[model samples]
Target: MKKKIKFMLLVYTLFLLSACSLRKDIHSYQKIETECDEIVQYLSEDDTEGLKSMFCNMTRSSSEFDKQIQVAMDYFEGKVIEHDPFTLKNDGSSVENGKITRLYSSPHLTGIVTDVGKTYEIKFYSYIINTDDEDKVGISKLTIKTDNGNECIIGEYIR
Candidate 1:
């Protein structure tokens, strides 16, 4: 009877641990989606500052960050009229003792935006997140483009 009880306890503990891991993964996916939503919101409003605030400290401090934002703003015409669901290109995490020590993800967002009477194809080709530094726990790389295939704004601040 004691052996059976011990076996049951072990099983229960294993179940709990697995559940916790699953919860963490769900949370990570949700966070990524939320960030994608924020990107769309800021872009639709043409809020440069708002967009800037979404990036990591490293990116925000870079001299080219402003230029990247300006380029995107200049290229991406108007409010987002429609967008395809954000695709989770890559997602990974390093967990130590049931806590996430590092996390990374790349989400791709594509949509259409209408400026006066014309619509343009807008694509946030890459939204990268690498949470290795606690102080800079935000987007490390971002790329935005319009229908013009050759023109793109890229912001890369990796640490």
Candidate 2:
């Protein structure tokens, strides 16, 4: 029947659309994971410029950005011996008009735990906003602390 054929076509079209969306989500997840890895590498190498490049323009331009980065570098010293990969905890995305308007994530576990002479825990919050006349992206918040103390040696929150 024509009705049956039309219904099948409709289902097929919906399936294809969902598949595309799923692929895009996976791609975004992979990208976030890669970013996490890059952050760890940058910290381990004490590559200030490389780490700065990862942040959004808004964050990079902040007056305290350099100072905050220096604090983190000072607190985390020596060669990093070990680190854990990103464990996604909370994540969300907003899509409008067939485009992603915003995306964010906070990993379940601390971003990284490294043994560089001392144990250090790093945590981060990251987001991306894509809209007309406003584009904010990359790691928006970061914290670095030694596991032996309660003090947060390095904290940077950029809006």
Candidate 3:
């Protein structure tokens, strides 16, 4: 009877550990999604400064700032008609341990050009990772394009 109780205790401990790990992953994914939403909001409002604040260190230089603003303004000239949160996709197995990984895909946004009476779809990709200090989330590899297949902006940095 004592042996059975010990075995059950061990199993319970393992289950609790797994649950904790799963919770952490879900939390991280939600955080990433929230960050992506903020990006969409900034772009939709043409808030260039707010959008630039999301970039990572490597790409957030004075020289690149104005250009970044231009690209966003040019791509999203009119008010945003629709915006969607980024969806996570499985990125396949990692080589190190064959662990299944997930990544954020390009979120979709649509805007109407009132001047031309044309609607445009904007798709942009962002990668989020935990910073070295583990206190902040870092964002990088921002690439934006229009429905016409024009690569309007590409950001290389993490913030």
Candidate 2 lDDT for residue 22: 94
Please write out the lDDT profile of model 3 over residues 46-125, one tens digit for every residue.
78778777765555654766686677666665555555545554211112233323333344544423343445554444
Runs off by more than 4 Å, candidate 1: 1-11, 112-132, 157-159
> Which parts of model 3 have CA positions greater than 4 angstroms off?
89-137, 157-159
Identify the leading candidate in terms of lDDT: 2
Query: Candidate 1 — what's its lDDT?
Result: 0.69
lDDT of each: 0.69, 0.70, 0.55
Using alpha carbons, what is the TM-score of model 2?
Answer: 0.78
Encode model 1's per-residue lDDT on 1-159: one tens digit a residue: 999999999999999989988897788778888888888778778898888887777777888888888887776666776777777776677767656777777777765555553344333322333345664577867776555554555467354
Q: How do the residues 1-159 of candidate 2 rate in per-residue lDDT, one tens digit apiece?
A: 999999999999999999988997888788787877777788889998888877766677778888988887777777666766667767788888888877777653252445545666666766755463243577766766667764443335543
Displacement of residue 17 (Cα, Å) in model 2 is 2.5
Clash number by candidate, in order: 0, 1, 3
Ranking by lDDT: 2, 1, 3
The global Cα lDDT (0 to 1) of model 3 is: 0.55
True-vs-predicted CA distance for residue 44, candidate 3, Å: 0.9
